[model samples]
Target: MEINPAITFQHDRKVMHAKRPKVLIVGAGLGGLTLGAILQKSDIPYEIFERASQVKPLGSCVALNATVAPLMRQLGIYDEFVAMTKVIPSIQIGNENREVEFAMTAYFEEATERFGAESRVISRPALYDLFLKQVPKERLHMSKKVLTTKQGGNGILIRCSDGTEYEGDILVGADGAHSAIRQNLYAELKSQNKLIPSDDAALPFNTISLVGQTRPLTTEEFPFLKKEECQFVRIVGNDKPFAWSTFTTKQQRICYSVVQFLDEESSKLHDSFRNSEWGPEAAGAMCDEVRHFPVISGGDKITTIGDLIDLTPKEYISKVMLEEKVFQTWYGGRTVLMGDACHKLSPAGGAGAGNALQDAVVLANYINALPLHPVVEEIEAAFEAYKTDRIEWCEKAYATSKMLQSVVDKGIKPMLVRFMMKNMPEFMKRRAAEQMYSSRPQVAFLPLDETPASVKPTHQRSLNLRAPVEEEVEAPAKTI
Candidate 1:
């Protein structure tokens, strides 16, 4: 079947441009790599710098919401995603023994069907692989950690850990929460006396995450476990911290985490996490407590639960901080920031990846427009337009994630939570499901008029023709 030419044009315009703008992308994680893939389709001279020596499968699972589907499709990796991951038709709130409290399958299905998109659960490493494959190997520079970035009249210069310097028309910091570029920007502002003397660092939320894979279990043995569902088994009322288990794969691959809210007293202890390790002894004790409840251990399947898996205790989770005013000044001269660097959203709504991917898409459109016009003002305008269009969506997602986390960490009893779950009206359950599954923001791009002429229709077609002519010219001088 023939693909639409317009779609092809939009996807390949970057490769056809005469002179692409130099784009420096920091970090090679999902957000950074996604941006790289989008830039690959356009005529954008770009490089990706990753701190790690090699890309590793870091996280367990990621929830790909409906909003991310279009971006994935645009990147030409949507089909591969579908094939590699499982579509979570619904989210189920259950207990330790697997007693369903509130089920939301129908609501999720309806929303997806209506929106022409589906939510998928995939291993983070798998998704990263997809993005990495789309980006050219030569363009990805691993083990090059960005130390600092300086913006001058001409362009931006990035200094790396190895003393190498990279000059580019635009620098994008797709780095995560601890962004070096962000810190540099703040330092610049501080030195100019534009900000206060007080420490601007955010207070760390006291929480710990323990992640591990479990042996496969039969559905019959684990009666409450659904085949394709992402189960959020909340254990409330325990003296310990709030805990939950998520099933990301059909083969019983599980991700279980417990979050403890540290009190003032507990926070004072510097080695509190080391002191309270959820090691084999702790896991055994917890298993014993859970085994008593059929719902948690799945009764007969209790034997299959792996021995206390790797424990990541007492790691400080960063709280979401919104720089509502600072976002207005995101584009400083030739350097810009995207993804978490531009807007750091809490992971509660699973919108970070989606939002970051959208940033990449919009930025690519803007950069592709540069070669045609080659105007500094136009480039800056494009960056402003990107921020204008995306700031609200990012802010909202961050706020929503924070709100949901607050509710889950309220210290309600497991029995009471389960009771509430069991008694929740079908309609209410559906509404909540819709809220979680349907909250994805629509993907929007900067107006085409805002796009530089280079990526615009006239210039795109011209560049496409020039390619054929150049090939012909090179082909000529053949022995005739």
Candidate 2:
């Protein structure tokens, strides 16, 4: 007779399961959904709350490159994500006259090969739906706005607006820039004189953008849609402080955005975006202003940004203020912030969404390392490590975002930036691309993706972390 190996493995799995902690996530945007998905795979219990009763298509498009593609694969959504996106081979930059200034074709191609993954763009709504599907319907609560949160009963607790309450060992504020949890946490920290001076300041923004995706069109209507490669184009205004971009997608539709770099006086008025609704109505004025902006729709036909605006459903178009800020304080007393809630970034570099997803991954990795009933010190240590591992990357992305923003802005600085980008030395440009593509973090608990790449990825410390397993002590020799 032999002991069963399957039984022994199951016993070990149960031991691992006993160390899992219950997670309470606020917000169901990309970050929150991503964390929930990983926890689902890790067999850790968690719940997600969203203020909206239904998920809305409020954004233009999100580009996923090598940065988070491996994690997407680990989560079992890579193929589906690829199918929904159009690979971006290059980005064509032009001026108000529609004259081509420069193109990043060679750079994009080289980076794609070296990174072992193609950069792909998908409509934001489509992306939201993809990640939302990974989370169980029961675990996601709609229209559940968190009113307040506190630590009690040997754990954390949250009270919803509807008078419902929940308890968990950890609370993750993956909510957007105007996060209620952050507000509450800051208020508490301020009372105790522990809040950082910068963290207490208002969220400053200097650019306002109008983003939308058009209804599907025929090849005859938009010839660019017929092309296998994405027609990615960016245009800088000659006189006005404006820049706009367009991308052809696999859905036979065009995703576009027009940005207005506000002046100092204008920025002061819209400096704090604490209470503002984002939707078509808020974007109506900006739409009218940029209606005449030119776009290359192929076939020598004249197309304006307004034409695409008309093709898009009113509900899908949105006006948003681009805010750039990285809060110094991330976690305090079982409450931690991730994504836009912690590091708000401008969309110029297409890094905001990717960073948010990365935050979810790194954070989930730390949460998975928690013991079944973790003490306060253990929880703080985990949050500190999560922030330590992520802040440097976020700051780098923020700086890159600012640099890209300058290239499209109206000023001598912008002109200089454009010149440098057009004439950047080959080695220098290659080094920059290498730095950008070198960070490809994956889920630590899942099997690693050994698919090789030319550039070595940065080491993720969380991959080396694991919860301590209780050692089996040998029974004392029988005294009887």
How close is each model in CA RMSD to the real structure?
10.4, 6.3
Candidate 2 colliding pairs: none
Tens-digit lDDT string for candidate 2 (1-480): 221212211133333435566899999999999999998987678999998898878888988788998899898899999899988887788877777788865447665568878889998989999999999899999999999887743677788999999888789999899999999999989998999999998888889899999999888777788788788889999888899999988888799999988888877766553368678878887899999999977657788999999999999899898889988999997889999999999999889999999998889889888765676677889999999999999999999999988878888988898888888888887788878777788888898877777888889899876755655655779986
Model 1 CA deviation exceeding 4 Å by range: 1-18, 96-98, 104-107, 193-199, 203-206, 214-226, 229-232, 250-252, 267-299, 303-329, 371-377, 412-480
TM-score of each: 0.72, 0.93
Q: How many residue pairs clash in all the candidates, one count each?
A: 13, 0
**Model 2: lDDT of residue 61:** 90
Segments of candidate 2 deviating more than 4 angstroms: 1-19, 268-274, 470-479
Whole-model lDDT per candidate: 0.56, 0.85
Residue 129 accuracy (lDDT) in model 2: 94
Q: TM-score for model 1?
A: 0.72
Model 1 residue 175 CA deviation (Å) reads 1.1
Question: Given candidate 1, what's the lDDT at residue 251?
Answer: 40
Worst 10 residues of 2 by lDDT: 1-10
